[model samples]
Target chain A: MSSVAIDLAAVNKSYRGKVVVNGVTFTVAAGECFGLLGPNGAGKSTIVRMILGMVPPDAGKITVLGKQVPAHARLARAGVGVVPQFDNLENEFTVRENLLVFGRYFSMSAREIEAVIPSLLEFARLGSKADARVAELSGGMKRRLVLARALINDPQLLVMDEPTTGLDPHARHLIWERLRSLLARGKTILLTTHFMEEAERLCDRLCVLEEGRKIAEGEPHTLINEQIGCDVMEIYGGNPHESIELIRPYAQRIEQSGETIFCYAPDLDQVRKQLRGRAGLRLLERPANLEDVFLRLTGREIEI
Target chain B: MMRMTYGAAMPANARNWLAVWRRNYLAWRKVALASLLGNLADPMTNLLGLGFGLGLIVGRVNGTSYIDFLVGGMVATSAMTSASFETIYATFARMHTQRTWEAMLCTQLTLGDILLGEVAWAASKALLAGTGITIVAAGLGYAAWPSMLYALPAIALTGFVFASLAMVIVSLAPSYDYFVFYQTLVLTPMVFLCGAVFPITQLPAAFQLVAALLPLEHSIELIRPAMLGRPVGSVGTHIGALCIYAVVPFLLSVALLLRRLMR
Candidate 1:
């Protein structure tokens, strides 16, 4: 048996003469929580689709649970669960019926599906809404139900694509706690999100993609330290060029955006001291995190 | 270049297709009464209104009561309507609006599994509508009871023909509005020219030739004889044509949907 849950080697995909996922490579180990963090259209969803065998890569090899993709995709899918970015729940069925019907797609018997409905509902905190129609549930409730539906087969690997994209913080935290429990149960997870904090909280290791290429890969803190240093100071409400020139010597690197300047340094004391007496300059200092690392590596340019 | 293989595009397991069928069945079971009533209303209305209202004027063509002639044609039309509505509107809703096909694709179910299952479900719904109308016709003394039973398989075949052809339209459909072209251009024309409302002999010679090539015309030819207990004419040709409609479009639908969804 292979220790790798998913393996992609030199994978490439293009659509209509335009490259989407270009020569990407990564491996998700068994029982490890791996995340793909990138902005929209960074090919995160495309990569997820390829792994699910929904689309074939133009070049390279992909294996999930030791089975070659698009060849053994059905077999691989039988062992994998997916929570999509969109709400694709069966609108005609009740919450419980949704779970039951989806379970049938995996060839599970009625009794087998019924046996897990209670526990899965509890896992999603949807026990009270079990008989409610999907349309009757709130967005949070629907998302929870989708999560429960993904686990109907008790899959060995769970794939989530922007799982909490539209949820409120409370709902997001609820899902995050459930995901943590799944990781504790030793389930391998492959997650994709633009939410860096979500990745930092749940992923054992993560890779950042920009324009179909992986720009950085490591543990959250390690990538932050390597790419962004220990602290980030933002100075707004001052001449951007003047701020950059003053903070340049003390900082490891400086970036100037419209109306503000960001300075990355080992420590913020010197930069703060240099800018203290300057009037009309508003300064804020924070510990460096994944978002800083993401912005620095992928750049501040807005992807159209 | 690696040629795209149908082996990867189409599902190999029969059980997976059946599972898709079962999923639709379970969902439909909740609104079973409303669904049946909705499917039955149009055909029943046409049979009563046109059979009596229009029958008063064109009374007893071809040695049978006008109502009797209309009953068999209505059975064929009922199957066509039910199957077309299911595959075109209902299947399109699932594919685009509800995103049900995408959800099923995430499971072990292939796009081919969903397609075949949808075709089967549409056919089954058509069988239901056709069977109900046949029973009503028999109750009114227009059709032979036992002979009408033989029309069940023929109704199923009619359902398959329309359902498969409608799915080909669905594969190309971008939205619900796109279905209007098919409904008006294809379905409406077939309803009028396929001997469902009037005898094909009434049409011009050129139109008669065209009508003979339609699936519904073949359906009516087989069904009319079976319902009236008359010996079927050109049994080989009628059934053979209907089978071609069912099968050829089914393959085309699979190929079209593969291009649409698998890309």
Candidate 2:
């Protein structure tokens, strides 16, 4: 078995005249959780598709596990699991049948699949709904079913595309907990997510992409520390820009969005001193996080 | 010298397609009774209405009673309709609406496997529909038993041919409504001109030429004689034509779908 689960070298892809992924390269070590984080149309889907061998990258090389992709993709996929971006459960089947049919696609016998169904249902918290039709399940239940279905083959590397895009806080936290358990069992995970918190909580190391190019790559806290510093000061309401000059000397980076001004620094002593008795301006100081890092790197504008 | 190479994984595995076929078979089994009855209802109506009602007026036009003459055509029509409808409607839902094929693609199965399994399932349904009508005709004393058993191969071949052709239509169809054109332009015409209810010889010379080209016409050519306990002529030619219809369209559907969806 190869220690490297996935490796990409100078991969390039384009559709018609427009470039989608431009010379992006990354490697995922065995049992390491790697994330591909980018805004919409940042070529995240194209890259993922290339890795899965669904589409041939126009240029560059890709290897998943030990097989060169789009050539030995079937052999490679025989050991990989994928949770797609949306809930596409087999609607006609019951929860157990859904898992059975998916396992069949992997060439598993019914007896073999039946052997694993109970444990997987327990893992998904869908043990009670074993015979329930897919439509009878809630959105969270359906999402969990898709997750459980992906594990039918007991894959070595799990690729998840936005695993928790729409879910209640409780369901989201449960899925996160399950993912943590998967990691604890030494399963490698490659995730693409729009949620900064999801990427922060799950990914051991991640790459941030912007307009088909990699802009930043590192650990969540390390990137936050290197770019935005230890503390972030927010000034809400009032003329927050007027205080920018006051706090500029102490702040390493300052940005203004709408009626709020953000100040990042090692500490808020200078901001606290300068903004003292600033009247209507409400100032809040907290530890900087991954969202702060993401916004600073990708910009606030919604990429269409 | 320039290097020329392309890499596209088209792993052709029989086991993979069998899995797809098994999935569809399992699902279809839930509604199998209703579906078979629905297919029967159409042909049964035509047989009783045209065979008995019209046969009373026509008497024996072709050396046999019109009711007995119509049994073979009805069997062929049932096979074609069942296979075509299953491919157009059920396969369409799996590919476009439910995104079932998309889900299967994420697994170890390839596009080829998915399509082959889908068409094979449709063909199986066709086989059942055709065989059902034959058994019904035999029970009603309209067809001979030992001779009717010979029609099974012909009926099975018609299933493959129609299922393959319908899948080609499905691969090219944009939405549900696009199927109306295939129904109107291709299938409905075949019914009237392919000797299902009437002999193609009664038509103008040009239409006879057209009817002779249809796969359903060849189907009836093989099945009618067998059901009537008569000699089947040009057996190799009819079988060859049906084989072309089955193999060509199936391969075409596979290629067309690869171009359409895999991109």
Instruction: Choose the strongest candidate by lDDT.
Output: 1
Chain B TM-score of candidate 2 stands at 0.95
Residue B118 CA displacement from its true place in model 2, Å: 0.3
lDDT of 2 by residue, A259-290 (tens): 77878877688778888887888888888877
Clashes (candidate 2) = 0
Candidate 1 residue lDDT tens string, B1-263: 22235677676587778888888899889889998888888899999999899999999967787888888899999999899989989899899888999999999987778888999999999999999999888988889768788789999999999999999999888888888898899988998899888888999999999999999999999998788877788988989999999988888888888777776
Q: What global local distance difference test value does model 2 have?
A: 0.86
Model 2: which residue pairs collide?
Answer: none
Please report the candidate that would top TM-score against the real structure: 1
**Error of model 1, residue A168, in angstroms:** 1.1
DockQ of the candidate models in sequence: 0.68, 0.52
